[model samples]
Target: MQTQCGGCKQGGARCCCRCGCHSTAASGGGARLCSLSIPSGRSRGGGGATEICRSPREGTRKAGRQAGRMATRMFEGKDHARVYQKYRFTPQEALQKAVFSYLDRKAGAFGLALDVGCGSGQGTLLLASRFQKVVGTDVSPAQVEEAQQAPHPDNVSFLACPAEELPVADGSVDVLTSFTAAHWFDIPRFMREAERVLAPSGCLVLTTNTLDMRLHFRDRDQELTRIFQEFRDLLTPYMSDKVRLVVGDYEEIFEAVPFPSKERITDIVDKVPMSVAELVGYVQSFSMFQAFLKDRPEEAQAQVQRLQERVLEAMGEASPEARLEFWNRQVCILASRGPVPDHDPRS
Candidate 1:
């Protein structure tokens, strides 16, 4: 299972897994011919080494570019962070129950849990009830500050960190969870970080609710659903490429997980009752919606007003007190470092 360069014996450093060739030389050469024996009929000449032509300066530049890209944050500004905190829903009880049930079956320490990309500590607080300690990390300093301000248990703390580079020790985390946030991460790099921080047999739970949502009303379910779809379509242009991964139900993310014992559960629907105004606020909480507001304030405001007016008209009430059901379909990807010997059969 280990991947390393033959010359440097360093994993994930210029090693070609297929040919077992080390692109960089271990003897301080700018480029070197791979010293390993080449198989016949391979890309390299028979019993001869193919020179790797990358210079040290070129490698440094490539590393710098990657670091810069990793530092880039999608959601910014204090105003947007405040909007998120105001409108985003807390972790559903059903989802929390499912996560705890899965973790209970695994034979490992439950002392520490890491919640990556935890916005405003909504999901992080849920972990505090189960684990002895919970640390939430996000790339946005504004979001981290907001999370810190929220009233949470003594065991819960918030930090500003990227998914690829966590401020944690190797194999020290008992459970790692990301709620509706993995889509915004660099999947491959984040997976590696998960591998590094997770203990043996530790669980990695990643979940996200899909954007293909629906709304239900008494005898007006069809009309409400249509209106919601229209609203979703209108916001489509504002969605980033990462959002497409959530739309795909995390299929690409599941594949990126390094664990062999991994499973994906999709279409776990939850019905939540809310008023028309609350639903409008939920839509406004979306990162893309905020981005749209920044890019086209007048157009975004008009669209929001139009959607709100249509919903209120359909409900046959000027008051926002009419209760409607919001059905959210969530996808969960569960993985562990090793096979659980006594996993719950029902889970």
Candidate 2:
């Protein structure tokens, strides 16, 4: 039997949560800010999830002071940073809507939009057309510098800072987001910074694509998918446990969100098309893959090359010319600073 999304019972089976993990970033380690109740069980297939639980929160004031104090060498190397800037997929239009649709309901000015963990600034630049000013902040100076070097409007800027701390003044940011990178954060501590920076009724959106990804080719979808899955499985051991937060759809992160007016949207799917070489570039941008390379450089290089060769073999084609569709499921967690509004959260 296929299970539905616990959030909406809309589609797909849900994945089970093994995340009994706890963090000291907040008080009362497992508390739920259940403005939106979560289903009792795990999500499966393309299932949606409605979750609730408990986790403590850090001091917002303290979070602000810690900003600019920690700039880790995250995504530091020149080649890695360049690949991250070039290969990382931008947040698709649907994901952006998941954020903006909620923000439209908000009551304050939409002057400043801050993107935490804004690696390479793809998502950050998307905000420029809407917000008066946009800032993308990351913990890696290298990533920040790459974002700066990119051609962006004057209204968009970049910074090197950690998620747990932000250098901005209190109640300054109108909309805050962390795309595909919140899993690497001390979420409870980061939530404190989220609370610190957002203006009253401001929106905070945290989003990431789940691991149930698929690679599709015109007539060879299933085979290409198997190959991709094989590649992912090989890299699994290299992935940090931090990725579990994403697999769990940020349930723990939601639990820790200091706000009471929070909800989630699940099963947002996006399909990006790329050539075999380009797909390899995207995979190479994975920090996990980078870790694998660090541990066994020759083996790592050999593995990806093998993956490329196998894919071409499967395609029965030359030149790696086959363009394939890369698909992913997205989950977005949205929280409002002050009160829950009267309109439909889904609306």
Alpha-carbon shift of residue 204 in model 2 (angstroms): 0.2
- RMSD of candidates 1 onward, in order: 13.5, 16.4
Clashes of 1: 0
lDDT of each: 0.71, 0.69
lDDT of candidate 1 at residue 272, scale 0 to 100? 86
Off by over 4 Å in 1: 1-68, 343-347
Question: Which tens-of-lDDT digit does each residue in 68-128 have in candidate 2?
Answer: 3542234657789899999887888788777777777763556668888888898888888
In model 1, what is the error at residue 111, expressed in angstroms?
0.6
Clashes of each: 0, 23
The alpha-carbon deviation from the true structure for residue 252 of candidate 2, after best TM-score superposition, in angstroms, is: 0.9
Q: Can you write out model 1's per-residue Cα lDDT over 1-347, one digit (the tens) per residue? A: 12234444433344431221222334442222111212122222234433232333343344334435784466557887887787778768667666777777863666678898887778888887776667777776567667767677766766555778775656767789999999988888899999988877689999998986888888888898899899878888889888889989999999999999878888678888898888888898887888789899999989988888899888787888778889898999888787766664333
